[model samples]
Target chain A: MNIRGLSLETIPPIFTPFRFFLSAPLSGILAAILLIYSGTDIWLTRWNINNLALTHLLTIGFMLIVMLGALYQFIPVMTGQLIPGSKKLASSIHIMISLGVLTLVTGFLSHSRIFFILALFFLGIGLCLFAGSLLPLLIARLQNQLIVFLLRILYLVLMVTLGLGLYMLLAHAVPSLEIDFRNYTDLHVLWGLAGWIVLIIMAISSQVIPMFYVTPEFSRNYLKMLSLAILITLVSLSLYQGGYIKALEVLLTLELLIFVVYTLHLIGQRKRKIADVTIYFFRLSLVSLLVGIIIWWLGRYLAQQTFYFLLAIVMIYGLAISAITGMLHKIAAFLIFLHLQKLSLSRPTAISLVPNMKQVISSQNSWIQFMLFLLSYAFILVSVFFPQLTVLAGVFMLLSFSWLAYCLFQAIRRYQKIQLEILALPEMKMSI
Target chain B: MAREIILDVSELEPPQPFEEVLKQLRKLQAGEYIKMLHRKQPLPLIQLLHENGYAVSMSNSPSGLWEIIIWKMSDPVSAADCNTQFGTNIIQADVSSNR
Candidate 1:
């Protein structure tokens, strides 16, 4: 593939992506706080309002929001097509989604139809604008079949998730619909978690691991086959309920296992054996994936719903959060430095003002956060089995996310500071 | 004869490759150009070159290697001379002036 065809011309302003990155940890902070306030009761069952609120807090507020940010960033790099009116689109999308998530979380907590109504309106318009905006661009790009394929599915499943989500919201908003929320709940989680989130993880990791880590590129045909397998299994999973389909039973776990092995192997073989913090996060993510599988496997044998709770904890807190944090460390640092570098270029005197990658977020600071994250993960895992210690887990989680927000904020703060100094220079000949 | 500093960063990762080029560009004098051999297109590096008052010539060799030749546009070089010496893969060889 002519990867260079991916142009920098379309890169949205630094704030466009940074705003989303910055918001993720804030969402994590809220999730952590909720985990604390909800207490051990959340560990009892997945359907409880407290647990549901916590789930959306992480899923929609944290994970999906970051993914949405990445969508804006990646579309330009992958396809070389700029969103025609990105600034306004991004601003509006950000506001709507922010409101939508707030209302949705409030709806869950209060069990209020009004909040649900407001959430559906906000998210519906927000998600539709997001989907509507992206659809045209992805359809136009045909160069790299793999990326185009991944992006198209990401769009489709997002809409699918949105549709199911809206339908569920309607059931809540209009009580006369008599919709059995329980029946669709399984399908909703399956599509949202596996089809949308996991596949996106697959799509992104396949490229990033190789490119960023200097690992061997995963075989194209192999990845295509893997993606196809995921698609087929997701369809089978939703359709077949009479008897558990073998592929459906095994595919999600099997795919994750394969991914873990594949990624670990690639990381092991990377050209530079550097002891970087991002590498540490990736390792933690892989290890978390393994633990998640183990927890899930153990869930099958347990009569108590505690194991299910453990599995979710391992997946969300341990796996998803670890990977997202790692990627953010690199991405936030890169974009900040790149923008600084660009700004510093106009005046040669400003060259010295630009911070190196490490200086943006020190290895020491990131390491501290990483360790805290691991500690938080450990406590969360233990809390599932030992509910009394749940408060402590929430503290660790809060500390970790707060540190994360700080570190991300530092990079942005530094960027703004340096950018101001550069702009103040006399005879500034260029502008981004 | 023109001066050339040939540096190969095929084995280095990320900011390393970009940093190596910046280091060369720092002490570079008039009529002296840096020819960098990299494994992939340094997109960020290219963007920096575009932003800064620098002239850049990037040619992807048939072996899937990238040979990037850049110099300060203030200290100009002739495109005709560069094209003859650097082979045919040069895309947007802004050697004579800035964009």
Candidate 2:
């Protein structure tokens, strides 16, 4: 636990976080492409096993993968503590988790019980290892009020999601369990989206938004209130599913309104006033959130499956992916900078080892990705009503995802080159 | 005449616990000066001191160690005044020579 020994080389600390960060978005791009290739009609046919697979491709593959990566990076910085497990243990966990995600997605699509069981086993081990590494650091650093509170809540919700997943898998394997799939599935989505995703976003936004823009501190009171409201509403919805749906919807609407206000306030207060690609993503995501709510409201009134499908597409593809992409741009650059800064202290003259983040990811690429994403989304919306344009929507989505993956891959290669430069430094000269 | 007060704090960490260190720095007589030596960059501490109405100057030693000197603005008139008033070397001696 010696501070000096916690160097980058000794721990290879950045590896998993970087890997996960790159992998999550790239997998997401691939998932998006897969959904598009399947055609809008097939993608929206929720009863189809392929639809479930496509959903998990985004949810488990892209969302959870990236979320876990961010968690690993943020937890240490947030708590001022290192991850508990050994490097070997962490690498193994990463491998298992990657394999598990692939297997589970494949199994769910094919309805292969063996793959399902194996996926469950691998994923469970990986998640347990991750939780084990994080939970202790959280407990020891309970003094950081924001971090401790968010981490605790996130962990609990993760457990709930995992539990539901386990039960669903079990139900698939054993019919006698007699669990209602619809009932648990709603709880599962609730925990996954509202609990895990939203809570983490709340926690991270507090730190990142201020830091990135060098803005004045956000109203801590407002953030805390929002967090509490979201947490309470989610919990209530989980417990009282049918009865609390209306109330939950109201709460969600209020939360979204607050978020929009907060985001506007942040942008207004930002030191750098110029528009950035990440900001574009943030704006798109917020718009998507608003649109998704409207679609949900419409679905409630009309009871149309198309509206529900539109809601999912907007929320998942438009909002979630945009926000995640925006975040990755900043987080990846920051991590690379942090590592380089640390390295520079040891090897000040080592061939100028820092990566130019601006060059690594271009605004043009981001804009292209964003436009393609919107085009695909528009196609999907059109297809839901028209059904004929589904194939075209699918094609657009596939192209957008492919472009995103390429952009991410280029960024990662830049990261690797920077790592190599550091490695090439002599032992005496190079810092961890 | 601006006066110099020397504070030899060679034992602080980077982004030094500024409030705690400031309390000791503030106790200097209105015309005295202080100098601190620390291993890491003292940018945060220097900024904190400046914000609290202290005039400060910073230089790095030949070995890349930090030397921060602080003085009350009201007392200093001449370089000689600083040198003779404190009865101690206003200019820091090379510590690497001893090493």
Candidate 3:
């Protein structure tokens, strides 16, 4: 593949990704509201209707939304080709998935067959549309790179997970399906979380952490081999469930351990050391993974729901959310800075001052959000045991997401105001 | 005599390299050229330069630095002449008419 063909010319408009990013925090806020409304029942078990609703809200509504947006922007950087019809495709997918997730959440909370049917139609169609647009791009131009290999595996796993999810939804919608729901749920969750979510994070970091931070590049040889190792372990785990391949499981644990250590080392080695909030988010994610992995490993011996609950909390709120938040900070600032620089070039006299990354989105604002995020995370952790503290956690979560949405909305507004100023210039009539 | 501006961009991250190079390009004059050294080829920057009546010759040297020597459309010292100075991957895009 001619990777160079994937340049800025091929990149979609900034608004394509921004739309998805702006919607993400609202979903987080919704999840928090669901938690608050569910009250004590949410703590009963992972299978609790409210618990399922909250998890889907975070997983589908927040993380997947952010990931899709990131991919629309990053794919050009990676592959030198844009997904075809990016803006329209993104807008349509966003609408379908957003509404689909809402319906799915309602289905879970109310246990209504009609809601389940609507969710099945919406989410299944929305996700499949995303896959339909994305898969061909990867297959045609992504070549044999390690990221591509892993992405292929990730996409396949996502499809399987989605398929199982639809099957379960159908089973709920139609009672005579005779499908084994319990066992399938285990596979679906594992594939969705571990296979797709965790693996994509690890793979993207192998490139991003180095390039974005000016840190040491991850060992190329290890990176080259890691995709296959992760794929094999996932497949093995799928087959074994909790049985043989103890060695494979051990290897998976080792891989995660290396991630924690490497992230710490990378942060220490960063070229610009005057504290950034994104670094804190990265550290939070890595530490959460370490803690989550340890709790999960220990769960093998304890066989208790508390360990699993803590693990889920750390995974969803701590690791996944933190990672997305960190990446979002950088991506948002970079894209804004880029477009501003472009405008500066196009209308040099009209736009004399282009904002730098920090000016676009202040570090202080991000820190405020980060602190709120941490407070909410702490509350959620405590609520895992206390159950009643969920209300407090929910309140903090609402504040955190509201702050994030406001910051992003303000940045985009700033971008637009500058754009209008540039366009209003009499000299800018012909050039750009 | 031709004027040469050298920018060392190896330590910077991402679009900074792209941005700094463009900022410098705005100051370019007739018979002047820029020599930018970065860790990776600034592909978008190269595209921008091509469209703005500038030509670029990029090389990944044995020392692991990308040297992009850029000159005006009228410059007699072509990107081909600079290709012999570096080790691998020479990219020369001439779009002076588009300017």
Candidate 4:
């Protein structure tokens, strides 16, 4: 009832999130390039260096970067709390993370022991700083709030994921370390994918889908228990990985099935009947989630390595990437539009008119980007079956990301141009 | 006398308030004004109204309900030309609520 989050007067500076948003697509383009040049051989086994490099490039480089930015931007919106830091801290965090991701990918591809160690150092410091920035705000308001509690858990799991990853890299680089990397592999991957990524998505979806899409709110009874359910599932799944209880896997799968179904139902009930590209992205993401889980479930009976690899691909690329892409397009455009609107209010009679969100980032451009992404996704799915199609998939990925980058860049450019035009007016000083 | 269109969009989730407000704005007559009750300021809605030559003044109550009255520029009783005290009260109320 306070409608505190809706009040934007105290939110962080625009560049804080915008810098991350702008950098994300470049990482996507890099991932596509890695896929193309690494060739079909890289697609055969998920354990290959190229495969590992490409996955991180997409997951850490693109998805995590965007999520980090969104967290910085939306946490304030969600909690009605200010992010603790100056604008300088935000920029530094962005730089550290970007550098960390770049170095980590380079280490994976080059097989340099020092690079791997440097990767750990950079990534560890950056992630810790990032988490520290949000921890205070989250800690202050976590009482009796399910979604924020889930987000807090997500951050905890992310730290665990990063720790396990560093240890794995350490073991690999120094065989004398005597760490069992294999023992931690599945746990590391699941905690990162299911714990951090999916949990954050669930938290955001619960708030956003209803708010943005004008859908019936998700069942309060079910949602209230979701964070606890997910936490229990993750803990149980970790124990199950250590051969403690087989039944936990079933519980985890059941939780996911319920989540996917509930999300689909909410999407179905959305009242807005418009040709929204963001909605299409959400549909693609939700469907991919279902498909990924089914593939994961089949791995118990099939026992095929390819199925496991395919499951990872479908989950990370198909599900996670698709979901974030939808979020990125919507959030980026909305923030720009919101800021421009607020700025324009100062000079009421200015000759320059502020552009609406749709006008700034045209629906037609987004649709084209979506179509390219869809085609690329289909090709990637096909490539999983016929490895020879990986290059074609790579090409499509390149085109899709290039188009995406172009659209985002164009929107940013438009925002800046309008800002400059508005500022040029002598009346702007009066409004501020 | 033109009647006021009262829209209580506080119960309706986000963007629905946004969408509904925009829709109602289209149907607004020259002499008519809308008294919209919402939980939030609905900044985007306010912006669109501004762009379309409408004037809006909103006040937030201590109970957290926001009352937004919007009228076209040409309207006799538009916020722009209303009793200065009415506008002053809304602004003072908004400031006090924030405090």
Top lDDT model: 1
Give the TM-score of each candidate.
0.91, 0.75, 0.91, 0.83
In model 1 chain A, which range of ten residues has the least summed lDDT? A1-10
Instruction: Pick out the ten consecutive residues of candidate 4 chain A with the lowest summed lDDT.
Output: A1-10
Q: What are the RMSDs of all candidates, in order?
A: 3.5, 10.2, 3.4, 5.3
Stretches off by above 4 angstroms in model 1 are A1-8, A142-145, A242-244, A428-432, B1-5, B27-35, B53-60, B69-76, B83-99
Could you tell me the lDDT of residue A20 within candidate 3?
Answer: 91
Clashing pairs in 4: none
**Any runs in candidate 2 off by more than 4 Å, and if so which?**
A1-12, A241-245, A351-353, A418-432, B1-99
Against the reference, the lDDT scores of all candidates come to 0.77, 0.64, 0.76, 0.73
Per-residue lDDT over A146-227 for candidate 3, one digit per residue giving the tens place of the 0 to 100 score: 5666667667767877788888888887778877788788778767766666766776676678777788767656654665
Give the C-alpha interface root-mean-square deviation per candidate.
6.3, 16.0, 6.2, 7.6
For model 2, what is the error of residue A126's alpha carbon versus the real structure, in angstroms, after optimal superposition? 1.8
**Candidate 2 A-chain TM-score:** 0.88
Stretches of candidate 4 above 4 Å error? A1-8, A142-146, A172-176, A240-244, A300-303, A428-432, B1-35, B39-99
Between prediction 1 and prediction 2, the one with superior lDDT is 1
Cα lDDT tens digits, model 1, A313-346, are 7777767778888888888888788787767666
Candidate 2 residue B10 C-alpha distance from true site, Å: 27
